[model samples]
Target: MKRVSCIDIGTNTALLLIADLDTQEGSIKPVFHKQTIIRLGKNVDEQKIIDHEAMQRLISCMTDYKHISKEHDVQQIIAAGTSALRDAKNRMEIIDEVVRACGIVIKTISGEEEAALTFSGAVAGMEELPETFSVIDIGGGSTEITMGNAQTITGSVSMNIGSVRLTERFFSSQPPSEEEFNAAKEEINRHLTEHLPPFFEAREHVYGVAGTLTTIAAVVSGLEQFDPEKIHNFRLTCEQVGNLLDMFRRQTLNEIMDSGIPEGRADVITMGALILHQFMKLLGTESIRVSIQGLRYGMAWKELQKLVSDGETTNSA
Candidate 1:
């Protein structure tokens, strides 16, 4: 078993997962996990920049994560950066500063890689997953849809539409005006119709990960705060998703937050929920099983595999 931490740095949040990866069991046992919203991709969609304040928030967050990892006595730290990092014009500079200050190296992954990693991680958490299944990971800046099984992936794609991106681009108010709502919907539709192909559509047994899905699950379960044990593996149906859309459709951000959703999520969740609603509608999906495990767990599994390989090489030498 190897004790390692995988940091999933996204457009809106930075999630940390520390786990004991057992090669023999092909399993990851969680030791610690944390999620922080820093909005790393705050204005990347509009300006293609990470900005100074965002960078400062990132460095400070990473520093805390570093101290936490040390407290847990983790052997390794793997920092994975997604959409925000992928589109940032000054990513390298931010990355260099992160290394200098926090001793963390941020590896920005492509959309395809993010999809595959998310798929692998989501399925790993489930007690029983189908031979053929797909996963949709909706983040702050991008959404990844991946179709695969236990062995290999058949199809995967990532789109540029996301909660924060849409919120910043179109949402002028909490619930947004009718025109703004229609405009956002149009943009979302264009991405889905143009980029997502026939193969990825009409998938059943879809697994969903990331903030958007989990927050919805929490709402469905009627919990004021997050409860991963209850939330994980929860089945969310099409009607439920639609109902959430209707519920949040008229509520302002403050109202949404008062309804129990966290501040980090309340503002953007309407857009996020809409993305899920539209995805399910277009794809003809009946339901999705929520998985709290995502990119970080996938990274943990990969790290374990590499560790096993390195050990074998050392023995041979």
Candidate 2:
């Protein structure tokens, strides 16, 4: 039983997954899972660079993850940086700092690769899946829509419309005004309309993964603490998404914080809900099934598969 770790450094948060991978069975037994919101994409959209404060926060978070991985004696760590890093002008500074400090190389993955990995991870552990489906991963700086089946990915697109980017661009006041909400919704709809139709032609079932969807599931379930089991595979209807969007839009940041929306996410969850809502409306889907599995899971699975393949080749030779 070998333990491997995977880290997904996104625009909004950094997530780490440490698991005992059973190569023979192709199963992953989770050992530790944690996420920290470092706002790594802060100002990246407007300034085109990672801010100094945000970089420090990300470094601290990665350092902590490194310590935890060491504690678990992880044999390998695969870290991938997404939208924020890809967009930032000064990304190499953060990458250099991370390697110098934590001894982990950060791979800045392209949008297509991100979508492919997400598609693989989102469908890996599921007991049931449609013959054809879509996986929508909404991150902080970008949204990845991947359509494929159990075996291969056919069409995938990553758009620049995300919760943080949308909120920063549209929401000007506390508890955004109706005009602001409408404006944001329209912008998101426009982006999806342009990019998502090709993938939606034949895909019927859409599964929503990543923080935004999971947080909505937690708040909707009214759980005092986050629960992956309850969130995973939970079906959310278009009407429910609309109702939640309305409910969240009226509440101030403090109110949302008080309502058990995860800390550091209260400000952007409303926009996130809106993104999900607009995506469903564009695709004409009535509901989306949420999955806890995401990029980190997909990375870990890929690594394990490679190891399995290497072993088989050596044994045959």
Best model per lDDT:
1
For candidate 2, what is the TM-score? 0.96
Reference-based TM-score of each model = 0.95, 0.96
List model 2 lDDT by residue over 156-262, tens digit each: 99999888887888998659999998999889988988997787764469888899999988888888999888998998888888998888999999898898887
lDDT of 1 by residue, 89-152 (tens): 8999999999999899999999999998888888885666677888889999999988878889
Which runs in model 2 stand beyond 4 Å of their true positions?
A: 201-203, 312-317
- Taken over the whole model, the C-alpha lDDT of each candidate is 0.89, 0.88
Model 2: lDDT equals 0.88
